[model samples]
Target: MMTEQYVTTSITPLESLNSLSPYEVDQLQDASQGGLFRLFRQCSLAVLNSGSELDSTKLVLDKYAKFDIKISQKHRSVQLELVNAPATAFVNGEIITGIREHLFSVLRDLLYVGTELDRRCSGLTESEATTNMVFHILRHAGAIRPHVKPDLVVCWGGHSINRIEYDYTKKVGYEMGLRGLNICTGCGPGAMKGPMKGATISHAKQRQKEGRYVGISEPGIIAAESPNPIVNELIIMPDIEKRLEAFVRLGHGIVVFPGGAGTAEEILYILGILLHEKNHSLPFPLVLTGPAGSEEYFETVDNFIRSTLGDDAASKYQIIVDDPHEVAEVMREGLEQVTRYRKATSESFHYNWQMHIPESFQQPFEPNHENMASLKLIKDQTDFELAANLRCALSGIVAGNVKEPGIRAIEEFGAFEICGEPAIMASMDKLLGSFVEQRRMKINYKEYQPCYRLKHDAEVVEEV
Candidate 1:
């Protein structure tokens, strides 16, 4: 049963900035079309709607039709006024402490990104400026620590996973936590929340008080994948590209669990970066693991990678199966190697300053009908370029699966048409079909209608 209660209140900062300059306050209060008010309202609603059972962004907004938030400048500081907010965020008429922090964290990042960073940082290309902007937003959120070694492991997986897979992720996280490694994830449910929950227990057992469970999300995703309560540090990037970049740059290593199109998109993003010739010698560890049943899933992924990007890209990551202890042991060993490499090269321990991410991957790819149809999924392009195009296709499928706009687009325009080489189209169709059959697409597991159509050449229509 769902609880029903509504409250309207004004909240002041707890640990965040209590005061802002007059100009800054005015900028926040500006509710005009080009102002920050819309961004602030959308993100604020997402925070208030945390722990919601509903995953559809449009559904969430429609349910809370009367919800509204306004920024007010007080004598000494600023306060946020909420109207008809979600009741679950409140306990005994007071908002939860962690949720409140997340709320303000959203405010902080949105404001900094919109006003200060954009105004100050100009004359930079799309990629360089975007990466620099992500760095600034993270640094302002106090997410980066210069003294910390390379121990943060970014875990990517679906929020809508099975109980067995969720438990497996928790077990892996527990093993990682026992070894004193921190966790970073997309900050939603299922696989994202399971690892943090397990790590919390292990952190308690080890008497580690400040075990960081960082959740990085974007505006388009936050409403669907609300920040799980375990997320102590939450940073909302401007878009999906920057958010993905933050994950790779801030963490020392990455661990991928069984997931859906979003997971596939993440995998492609990392592979694209690692495929860059300049990043060849970098000591970044990539591992794909799951329980025994998930072996076939990884095999599909491995085969797809080999078929698409060739053997060199496949060599960038290792696949481990059904061993939580070994996963942690291998991650720890990798981190040690990372530390040695960073020290020897005099690179920063907190961020991967040496890795080169092309503008193709850094820029946001709008998964609209035209953009989806225009993707070049051929083998003739460079390996990195092929990875980028594959990444875009996966991203589009992810959008159609959960994102409200993409869902509506699919409903109106029908399935997105993806044209590519015959072999590549066959490989993609097989992998995506496996994902759907495995129930990895959406949280609502009745039956999934694919949002894409694969075309090989002008004549061949491949099965999806």
Candidate 2:
């Protein structure tokens, strides 16, 4: 594996994180409890492995088993020494500037999370406090701009998607960019990269030199999906929940591309937030669009949402197909609504402080088998609460599909058993089956092995 190809080099920070306190430096170097050294090392390796096709975190880690990164504390600055790093990160024996920046971003975020965040976030259990944590983290990472209008459109989709769908994302991005809208994404490959890549050209054509290409990722998932090169501004959140929160809080609208479990998780997360009673008056745009080939994919998705979350949930988002220009037009219209709503309500352009996120959505859902099995699938709870639980289920499947820990867990425990109301289970099983059959579960997938089992539904064939 090229991931094991060794390289040894010493690199200094180019701009951000030039200097660090001695206390911070010492803590970063320590591998003991409360040390951020290992976290920093893995994240750096992931960034260095950018543009990789591999999505299995375990495979990536195993291939680069001996990869190592060390920090050298300086008199007024800090430096990183790499050993056994992926050769792809370097061109002509120098790390690419974007990769270097992403590398430093990994360091900045992990350090902030390990050292400052907990102390600052301590004693804050309220939902608003959790949202506040997201704001402060983004503020520290320079993601939230004070005077910027509602222009950032957060695009969500699967890393494993077809060429046509990917192109559609780019086209939509180009249209949006021509309209002077910025782009934000989960910051990985596939749909995430396409829009930003498209927007760059459009921005250049429009003489817009200053553009924000924001990519937000979390440590757990970053290893599998490294920051795409198109991302000029990268922020590493501590966990997936916060990362999702950052997207909704900062972006004016959302554009969803065709994706698998991870995409499903994102859809549910936003719907859950929008379905909240407090958010009924708020004007956040959510458009689920794909290329012509993705009609069945979106149909299944829409069916699942309607079957479970009901017609009201289905009504919250518009399904747009084949026309990227229309997608951008809807986004523009939605932003206008958002802008008007903000002006009338006196809300900040940068942060949606008024949007109410339930603690269930804010609290991180660890995707272990036990947790997956315990997910509430009954319709008795509020629509928003049900959406949150459904989000957790999809989230667990995503973990089993890619994240190293979740992969290992699935291998050890067999497929995660999903038992719930029979109707809901049947709908979920059918939706996931469609994803697998259409090869949405992963890129170039020959066949998908089930990482989760719908135990309550027998009509679906069980993978043994």
Candidate 3:
């Protein structure tokens, strides 16, 4: 049985950006193609649809087919009027405070990104430009907390996890919270939501009221994975690349759980950065963990990484199985090391400004059929470049699995063709097959279909 609820409410702005210039307000109110109204509408809908069980972006949009949001400027400030909104976002006919704040946050970030990209600040290069853009977005959302030592741990995993794994995430979160650490994640359900939910109880038990639960997402994914209610601070990046960059840059350390293609993309992104010759000495802690039943999952991930990127790449992170206390203890020690390293290196505590991210990782990856088929997935290239290509391959699989545009593209065309070295393709095929068998692809779909086909041709070898 599914819960069906609906509500309509008009909310006024709160502490941030309540005041907008008449021109700015008018621009937001404009729904024309050239205006910011469409962006605002899509994000607003996602915020209001928080806590939904739906994981398909297209499904969520279709369920609330009649939903609409209108922006109006008042003499004192701005107001949002929602029609046919999801009732789950309300209590007693009033919008949930957190959801309301998130709605406005969507407004705030969309405007800032629009303005910043328009100005093209300082004519920065691709890497510098991406870093600056991430900084600006975090600053706009007030996510950067100065004077606070590196303690924020970013958790990444699938939103459609099993009961035991979900509970294991919470246990890890409880341990982390008991140690007085904060949590950051993609802000959807399952593993993302589990840690925060567990931490809340532990925080209350420890009488710690200032714990932070930050959820970072982007426009393309927000609808599919609606911000869980526990996410007190929400920031929507402009795209997936920026969102992933935000996670690595803002977080002191990262803990990866068992997940599908999306999680693989995240692992590859971080490993690619760590594999860079310049970053070999950086003290960034990466851990892959889960409960006892999840041992096989981590083994598969380890095997895939070792077979493709080699043992040196695998040395960057540690795998701790079925022990939440050890996970938390190691994370605390790792974060303290991160703090000391930052001070020793004279790096900023809030952001990793010293980390070197190559242009290949910073630039956006468009997962079209041709681009997917053209990836250089062989081990002959440098480790960092191989990681980059592998990241793109996983990213394309992610798009095909749940993203609306990717799903639509598959429907219109056909399965995306992924042609690479025979060895690489075979390993990728095995990993993807494992994800499917474990049911990590989609939450509610009856049967999952392959959105991509692996093509191994000898002629492609010469081109590479």
> Which tens-of-lDDT digit does each residue in 176-199 have in candidate 3?
999998999999999999999989
Candidate numbers sorted by lDDT from highest down: 1, 2, 3
What range of 10 consecutive residues in model 3 has the weakest lDDT sum?
455-464
Lowest summed lDDT over 10 consecutive residues: which window, candidate 2?
455-464
Error of 3 at 154 (Å): 0.5
Model 2: per-residue Cα lDDT over 298-364, one tens digit each = 9999999999999988889999999989999999999999989998998999999989899999899
Q: What is the lDDT of candidate 2?
A: 0.88
* TM value for model 1: 0.96
TM-score for each prediction?
0.96, 0.96, 0.96
lDDT of 1 at 332: 97
Which parts of model 1 have CA positions greater than 4 angstroms off? Answer: 1-3, 29-33, 123-125, 459-463
Q: Give the Å shift of residue 180 in candidate 1.
A: 0.8
Q: Which stretches of candidate 3 lie over 4 Å from their true place?
A: 1-4, 30-34, 117-120, 458-464
